[model samples]
Target: MNINKLIRIFFLLIISSIEIGQSLVPVERHGHSAVLVDKKLYFFGGESVFGKLKNSIHLDQILYIDLSKPFNTANPPFEEVINAPMPFGSSYATAFLSPQKKNIIYLFGGIMWDVNANVDKFKSILYSYNVETNEWIPPATTGIAPEKRREINGVINNETGKFYAFSGLDTNAQNVVTTFNDMNILDINSLTWSKGSITNAPLPRVDYTATLLSNGIIVFIGGRETNNLVSVDINQLPLYDTKVDRWSTMTARGVTLENRNSHSAILTSDEKIIVFGGNKDDIATPVLNPLAVLNTKVVPYEWSVPTPAPPLPLTTNLHSATLVENYMFINFGQVHPKNDSLLQKPFFYILDVRNFTWVEKFEPEQLSQSPNGTTTVNTSSTNSPGLGVTTPDNGKQIGIIIGAVGISVGVIAVAGLLGYKYYKKQKYTRAIPTAGSPTI
Candidate 1:
């Protein structure tokens, strides 16, 4: 090919290569927790779609997103947990890694869907799944525990070996729901529950964040305070002093966030909490500065909203987020990109927390359904389809896509080089001197 033609082909190849390498996969979901264990991200149960639709279902599969995978690949990065005890898929449940036990994840109460009753049910069961042993065990506890609740969050105080739970929604036998503005603690060692002594508590709230700071202080952030379900001021930075057993609102300086609930936040290595992707005015709005950072290491706690913040992969709420290494992996939230409608697709995105830039978006593979209209993973048993009845190999399709993209780019690169070489040789031959020509 001529030099001009070669140049044109080279530019096209470069563009295609870049585009392929920059795509992201976001898992469509909400009300799920993305737990980080070393390099792997473990995503537990969550609500896939919300509304009165009888077909709307809760996601029960325990999915693990391998963050180690190259970000350029546009494929389902999620894998269902295999040979593990799966919970009866739930949403709004709190999950935390056991500080004392290696690879143990403790899951607390959440809301589950009961098809028979046609209502969301609150659960009080606490189960522990050991990632190392691939076993699930129910720990027996003593003392008075909180009633079946949902929309709460907690943190484990490694020093005391205790798990502290904050306010959540309480429902009665008649299905009457009320938000409880109380605190509860579970002893990790004894698996015992007890009431916590907290004064001046915030109003009954749900879907808030409980971040354990470096100093062992659990900072409670935005939620739907009161049964009215309105967003409270971001300035009300409530701090739970586990040591003093007292709750006090801290003075926050700098840019305050818009009131929101069902959002997700992560405690950074610098002792700052980065909050993102929540509802404003009860619905997810497409807006800049959906992200905020709280500098908990400093006195009077300063809140800084990053100027020119990166846009979220989507405007969403009721999502779960956790920090792993330098990147924050946020998966599945309720997307409300339009005013007339909302969707509960399991999509997720990753953010480079260092610069607050979005790294990529990922989408999980479309789950296959069994004949009974239940989702099945890896051809598991036909019994009530819980989070993955069977361990299905989900990464094969993604690997093929990645390999194809890589090969396409490679072939294009080689062709361009060859074209250039051929053009250079043709030009040299045309300029060569004949046998009798002067070698000037």
Candidate 2:
């Protein structure tokens, strides 16, 4: 190959590799957690089922992907941390990094299938994993820990190393599933649990995601009440003021988000809550990518439909997403197609929050012909604190970067090749004693 061709081929290979690497992940399942540390993503226990009547399968292996590495699906930079297996296989538990210690991930409360009893068992044990050592530490605690539960959500106060465990579902003796409205804080330093005073808390709920704001506010949205698995109204958003140890509701301004459960909601570094991928009253709503952004900085918080949405290759519920810099990594959700088959894959997707654009890992052959991209929703008031205004029009910046890089590489390659050829030609002419040239 010519020098220019070789250079062009190198850039293409890099782009191709990055595309493939983003898709390399663990087996597809819901109830799993993808915890981000530095540029690495650590994936842990989740459950899947092969047949309708078959027993639910719980995942035990620990897999992680280093985002810094080049994309290689077959030889991906995924490392399976072996040695200590979880005390039991569990799912829908709360996973977060300990604010007090470095390299420690804490997992609390999840459900496990009891094969012998043919029932689901809830776990309340607190397990900590040392990310640096790849070891599991089951920490014993004092005070009253919350009841055994699953599908619960929690957030850590990085400043105090205190983790707040929120409401979740539990099974009663009669095989009845129950939920809690209880709130408790686990102090990583003391290894103790203490109940917190929650005033005007919402009803017993599960499958909701919570985001902690810099101002010590915890916003909980889109979960099912124990009585009904149906969607909840968006008007009443629950905001917990950690400073006062109380919970209150806020009337959402502007557009209301679609009522959803089993969705992924994350607080971006820019202080906006980005919610994506969930079931709207049991129907998959994948078309809602960029799903919604709530500007929490403003009082009487308002919700806006995101611009430059992603392509919905499939409808998903029960997925998890975490934010890292300008990129949000989402993975492992239940896909419900029109054929009525429930599917889960280990693939994932990425959203560039800076521009509200999407990065897809997998594109099925039978994608819906839905219109792509989001229309401009009502804009937040300029008075809203720290609102970084961006538009769908600016989304082209990402595409431009990729195109520019590829073009730049080609131009440099061509220029270098031409320079090399010209030098060679001049040297050759000189060596041939052209005109008054002297022979050595």
Candidate 3:
């Protein structure tokens, strides 16, 4: 080959390497919902192109995938728990199991109308599903019934059995849905409601955040009104206190977090709300914010340092980020320069919160196998298709029940390899770099 051609080929090779290293993978569909039950993660209904909500998990009317089994894996075509239907067969409702009340998972108001402004018509109703009884109880009308709301954010303070519902859009007389500032606290035990006209509330916004800190205070942030579904910054907005049901203008310590919506927040083992990316307002889509992390009490909100970790590999995407135990799992989301309307199908990435690092891409099969024993039959079977049907689990499916924990072992392994490579590369590169001697 000609000398010039050889040099050109070498440069091309380097470029190809860079591109390959940066390639993003295709995950699952958009518009899906997820909840963490008994350490395992269960994803439910999502909107499809046909515009019909899908219950792909259920064989008949029930959701098909419980995903709490030990043998579950992402290898492909794995068995999902085809048992049990969601309380009302609803989607887009903020869903989560109460940490203190294992028997129930609380799903509060949600709808699919406005991406930013409130669409006047939305269901104010919220319900809870009892995993043990397989029953759905609507919020009591006189007791804890939420003020009629849709698309509002809900957070449960398990310690106090209080579910705090805040900042959503309401319909005007002409039937126009606009942003609202109403804050209603619902008691899970008493099924009672407390409507507090909170003072100095964050401006009327939707898609904003209200997270329950380990200290038992509520941190409110990122949403939109006439604007878009993005908070200017987690730092810009003040965090709220649920204990007293009050608002404060203070911030957290350390690195200020990026404003995000459609993103998930998890309470880390060490007590921090590790935030991942969501859609950015400047753009019409979701993107990963590598610089997202929050730690501290809420009253006088302070900023904390974000882990100098890898960015969400792509932009203009939103995924269901679920925290199982200490591990943070981000499920199938989209990427866009392509626009939010076009997101990749669902897949997942995990972060080992204890170690403060992001995990490499792996399917469900890569996780640890769950412990095997007699299936707990205390669970009543209803529309749930396939429960208590334990054949010989492949060990992979059962691992999911063990939760994001299996990934912890993998994190250790990956860390060892990375450390070894870094040490060797630094030593070898250092030994080779003597510019004065190499000049010959």
Candidate 4:
């Protein structure tokens, strides 16, 4: 083999931007949110950094990707922009779209950092976006927003469009500790938010999973407290029914489906809830494993041991996931890399939940893809007043600085060379509307 040819081959070798099984890039931040609307999936702000604590690097821009369209690295579907930016930059904000044709998505208060790195208090701002006009409007009714929530679960009762939120962990007095148990619900049609009846509610947890059952029941899964302890036995998760406004005291016994947080609850089309890849043995350094979820409808006290289910391609936490028609499209998230200081690589995988198969192979050349690289910068900016940007002192690119720079350069260069010719044709040439005349 010629050495020169080898060098050229290396340069041409397109290490894929597509992540098949393991993450191609590390998704550093957690608590970011995603939704599917207009056959397109949209994602909003969340914190991303190389620290145990959440940071103030809030992203104000929205990311929308088409689900119906096939995505390829060689030819990717371009992301479309919607109406206007939200009022402020935020992460872990609670949002759910009204299920009507309007497909209006509502966002309630979570938390945002002012231009300063100091994480701002939970916001009371409530706004909704319309899929049709790409417009935002405040609902007619106004009242107190949920006390600034952080990890509270976001579940829309499929029965009603109302969103059900539960406990989440947040920083208390100092950045040193964890925050806990608060529950709230919002009526989408009226745009009114009110506290849910709290009785035997589970202790405050940050990363719990909630599954709205078909039998008009809301099942709350494993979520731990601020102290990182399970208030209930690891073997059982506290259950609640929003419809009856009562608790299912039956500790789902026997099965080791430990009520764990940061796990995924994907309700399958066949009406079975599939819980996958969450830390169980420990929470501090979560050990992610796949567990099967049984119907266990209404029989609140019975706990069935989860048959060791098929394994996911990778261990992921803080990654974004959504259920498409036949598959679950999980986006990039962080893995505890051996080297903590350095960023983890981000990657995505498509799970065929129906067949219980995690795709290890795909038409790599044809799969939809993007380069989602992560870097941290202090986004503490005072450009505006109270609503300021966090300008990172250490300069960084959160994702891509995508804009018109490339197009502008190309257009300007071409225009300069063709300027004289165009001018000459206009000034010296006679105007004629001939049948075959060139348009330009």
Q: How far is candidate 2 from the true structure (C-alpha RMSD, Å)?
A: 12.1
For 316-435, candidate 3 gives per-residue lDDT tens digits of: 234566554345666665565554344434455666666666666322323333465533321111101111222234454457635444554555555556556667877898777575
Instruction: Give the candidates in order of lDDT, highest first.
Output: 1, 2, 4, 3
Tens-place lDDT per residue, model 2, 381-409, is 10111222223333465687688777767
Q: How many residue-pair clashes does candidate 2 contain?
A: 2
Which segments of candidate 1 are over 4 A away from where they belong?
Answer: 1-27, 50-56, 82-85, 113-123, 132-134, 284-288, 308-312, 337-345, 361-440
lDDT per residue as tens, model 1, 191-270: 88988765788787887788877566788888877678787777788888888788889878888667887788877666
Specify the poorest-scoring 10-residue window by lDDT in model 2.
378-387
TM-score of each: 0.70, 0.71, 0.63, 0.65
Q: How many backbone clashes does candidate 1 have?
A: 24
Winning candidate number (TM-score): 2
lDDT for every model? 0.67, 0.67, 0.52, 0.53
RMSD over all Cα atoms, model 1 = 14.7
Q: What's the C-alpha lDDT at position 217 in model 2?
A: 80
